[model samples]
Target: MSLLFSEEEFQSAWTELDEPQLDGGWELFTESMGVKIYRLYDQDTGLYEYKVFGVLDSCPPELCADVYMDLDYRKQWDGYVKELHQDQFEGRPAVYWQVKYPFPLSNRDYVYVRERRDLDLDGRRIWVILAHSSPETPCAERSGVLRVRQYRQSVAMETDGARGAKVFMRYFDNPGGMIPAWLVNWAAKSGVPNFLTDMQKACSNYAAYCQRK
Candidate 1:
C-alpha cells in the first residue's frame, strides 16, 4: 500500500519544510509517520538551481542492506550521496549496499568484494559482509548483514616535481562511514599544505614511476 506523486505534489504536501531561498543550498524538513524523507539542492556553474529528494521506511534496514551489498552497484550507476559533508561529494559516485536476507537467519555465508573505481585506481575497493550474529543463536539475521567491508589502498601521486603517497584507507574502518573528529579538527587538515611537497617529490622522482621507456 504505497503511493507516488510528482515533485511539485510532494513538495506541496509538505509545506512546512519549504523555505524561500537562493539557488545554492537545500534543506530537509518533516514531521511524518511511517516514512522518512530528505532533500537536496544544487546550482551548477551555469545552470538553474533545483532540488530532489527521497523517502524510505522508518527503520531503513532494507535500504541499508541494499546499499551495503550491491556488488556491481558502482557499474550500473554511481549511487547518490546523501550527505555532502561526509564524502565532500560534489559529483562523486555514491556506492550503496544491498541485502539478501535478514539477520540471525543465515550463517553459511562467505564475504564478498567490490572494486573502487571511485578513487581512480583500478584495484581499490571496499568489501561487504555481515558484521555480527544474533545473540539468541549463532545464526544470521533475517535482515541479513547490515555492513560493508573495504580494502586498504596506497597511491603514489606526483605533481610539480614532488613525490608522495596517499593512503586510501578509512580514517577508520570505513572512512566512507563517519570520519574521526581529528580529521576535520587538525591532523588531516595539515595534509593540504603538504600537497606541493608530494608533487615536488614526484617530479624529482619521475624516473621511478617510469620503466626506462
Candidate 2:
C-alpha cells in the first residue's frame, strides 16, 4: 500500500517528537492545563515553533487518536475553526480548514494533506497524525481570508501504562500579513494551552458519546 507521506518523513517526525533537543533553540515557555509548552525560533524563516506535551489520565491512546481524526467532533470543540471539509489532493486525503482570527486580522485558511500511522516503538504502540499545508490542492483563496502559505502540525500519542495517554504536538504556521511579531508570540504562548485543554475535554466527551452508541 502506498502512503501519502514517505516512511522517512514519518520516522523523522516521530523521532523528533519522541526525543526533542531541548538545548538547541528550544526553550521551555509555560506549563498550563497539565501540558508543558516550548518555543523555538526558526532562524531560517524568523518564525517560532510551538511544541506541547502532556498526559491525559484515563484516556487510552486509541481514544485520543479517534478524537483527533474525527472532523465532525472537531467543530464542536475547536472554537477557531469556522469551516472544515475533507478533500483530496493528488489522490491523497486532504482537508480544508478556515479558521477565524481576532479582530482587525483577516481570517486564515489552509489546505493540508493529513496522514495517520500506527507504529510499534520499543514494544510500545504509538499513533501519529501529521498535517502539512499543500498548495497543490486546487482551492481558491476566499475574499477577506488569508491563505496560510506555510504550515505543518503533528501529534503523537502513546499509551502511558494502562489508563493514560501521553500526547505531544508541534505546530508552526506563517500567517502572511503585517501582523506584529509580538502579537504572534503572545498568541502562541496563551492560545495553545487553551486549545489543548479543549481537545482533552473533547476526547473525553467523544469517548462517552461512543460508549452510548
Candidate 3:
C-alpha cells in the first residue's frame, strides 16, 4: 500500500496516466497511478477503467460488487479471493504482472513470464503477482480491463518460496488479448463494466475484514 514503485517508475506512469486525460486525482497522482491502476485494493470493488467522466456516479454496494466480479475474464475474479492465513502464508521474492486487453487473442494465455516470481523491484522483499482481464471483444464504453495485484513476501531465505528448488508459478490468466486500440476506439463502446484490479482490492479489503472478525 505504501509507494511501491521507484521515483522513475512513478514519473513514467504519471505520463501514461495523463496521456489519457481522465481527471487524474491528487490521491491518484501521489500513488503513482497505481492507486487508480490498483484501485480495487482500496475500494474493495471495480470501476470502469476507461470512465471518461465520473460516469458511474454511484450504485448499490452489492450491485457494484456483483457487476465488478462478472466483467473480468478470470473465473470468480472476486470469489477466488478468500483469505490469507498469517500462519501458513510465506513471503516470496518474485512478482508477477498481467495485463488484458478488450479482445481475446489466438494462442493467448501464453504471456506468463518464466519463473515470474523472481521478478521484483530492486530485491524488495515484496512479491507482487498482479493479474488483469478483459472480455474477448472489441473495445467499447465500459469495456475497460480488470487487474489484480497480489503482494507476496518471502517467509524466509531458507524456504526457496516453499517449492524447494523447483519452479513455481506466480501469475495466471483466463485467455486472450485485445485488437489494436485504433479499432476499438473507432467503434462504438457498450456494456456494464468491471475491473479486475478493483476486484482484487475489494477482495483484499474483505479478506482483511474477515481476518479481523
Candidate 4:
C-alpha cells in the first residue's frame, strides 16, 4: 500500500524526531521510569504538547518496533487500548484504536494511517513509526465514545548496541468534550511514565512470546 502522507510530510516529521526545540513556554513536567517528560503550549491547537524520551535496557531496536506493529497483540500489554483493528483507505493502510477512559469520561477513538521506516542517522540505525488521525477514512461513530478529531503520535527507536534501544515519542491529542486542561496535563504527567514502563516490559515479553511461537 502507498503512504497516506506525502514526501514533504514524511521529511518534516522525520526532521522533528531530533527532539524539537521547545519555546519559552515549555516546562519540564516530570521524570520517572527513566524517562524524561516535557510539556509545552501549542499555540496552534490551544493544547499542551508532550514529549517523552528514555532507553529500554536489554530490548533491541527491531524487537521494540515489532511490538508496536503487532496490532493484534496490543491488548496483551497496552491497558489503555480497548480495541484495535486495521483497514485500508484507497489502498493505503489505516488503523482504528479505541482507548479506555476513567469513569464519568467518554472513551476516545482514533483512526490513522501508520507508516514506518528505518534510516541511519549519524551512523546510528533508527526505526520510526508515525501515525496521524485521518477523518476522511469512512468509519461509523461508536455510541458513548468521542472520536479524537486531532491526533498525531510517533515513535523513534535507535539501537543502543546489543544491550537495548533508545526510544523517543512525541504525542498530542485533543480529547473532545468538556475536560479540564489541568486534568489533561496531570494525566500526561502521571500516565506517561507508567505507560513507558509497561512498554518496556511488553517489549521483553513479546520478544519471548515470538520466540516460543
Alpha-carbon runs more than 4 Å astray in model 3: 1-6, 14-107, 110-192, 196-205, 208-213
lDDT of 4 by residue, 1-213 (tens): 335656564455556446565667767788875777788887765678787777788788888888888887787788888999898767656799999999989999998888888777687677888888989888878999999989988877877666888877888888878897768877877677887778778887885677766
Comparing 1 and 2 on TM-score, the stronger one:
2
RMSD, candidate 3, Å: 16.1
Steric clash pairs (candidate 4): none
Tens digit of per-residue lDDT, candidate 2, span 57-113: 767888888888888778878889999989765565679999999898899999988
Per-candidate Cα lDDT values, in order, are: 0.26, 0.82, 0.26, 0.79
Instruction: Point out where model 2 deviates above 4 Å.
Output: 1-3, 16-18, 89-92, 208-213
lDDT of 1 by residue, 41-131 (tens): 2122121111222222221222222333333332223222221111112333232334232243322222222221221224432121222
RMSD of 1: 19.8
Q: How does model 2 fare in lDDT?
A: 0.82
Estimated TM-score for each candidate: 0.19, 0.89, 0.24, 0.87
- Residue 186, model 2: Cα distance from true site in angstroms: 0.4
> Residue 148 of candidate 4: its Cα lDDT?
93
For every candidate in turn, the CA RMSD to the true structure comes to 19.8, 2.3, 16.1, 2.6
Better of 1 and 3 by TM-score: 3
Which has the better TM-score: candidate 2, or candidate 3? 2
